[model samples]
Target: MSMFDKTTKMAAVLKGHPKAKEVLESFGLQCSTCSGAKHESIELGATNHGLDVNELLTHLNALFDEPPGK
Candidate 1:
């Protein structure tokens, strides 16, 4: 299983994958402490931020897909 899916919540993703924080930040979503992360889906957040959700999802999933130690 991947670390994140489109429906995955920001909090859950960050909790499960620490490296995800960097990716989220790169996507302009520095919401580590935001309440919305607790319930907002990745897609929703991306949409709200006027970002490309698919690109974000791909980047997020790809980050986890990489072999350990890149």
Candidate 2:
């Protein structure tokens, strides 16, 4: 399973990924718990949040490159 699958909450994605959080917020996603986020996958969220999906995908993949708990 992908790291994304290992977690059930958006907060988990950012727990060890401050850079990724910054990137997300830069796209105006103030909170993963925000209503809009509930209906969007991170990929879709990035698209609708005014982010460049390709860039976000690259960054997010990098964030997960290191094993968790490192």
Against the true structure, whose TM-score is highest?
1
Cα lDDT of model 2 by residue, 1-70, tens digit: 2355322244555654656667567666675557554445666666566776666556666766767765
Instruction: Give me the overall lDDT of model 2.
Output: 0.58
- Residue range 29-66, candidate 1, lDDT tens digits: 98797889998999899999999998998888887777
RMSD value for candidate 2:
4.7
Q: Give the TM-score of candidate 2.
A: 0.50
The parts of candidate 2 lying over 4 Å away from their true place are 1-20, 66-70
- Using all chains and alpha carbons, the TM-scores for the candidates as numbered come to 0.87, 0.50
- Clashes counted in candidate 2 amount to 0
Top model number, lDDT: 1
The stretch of ten residues in a row with the least summed lDDT in candidate 1 is 1-10
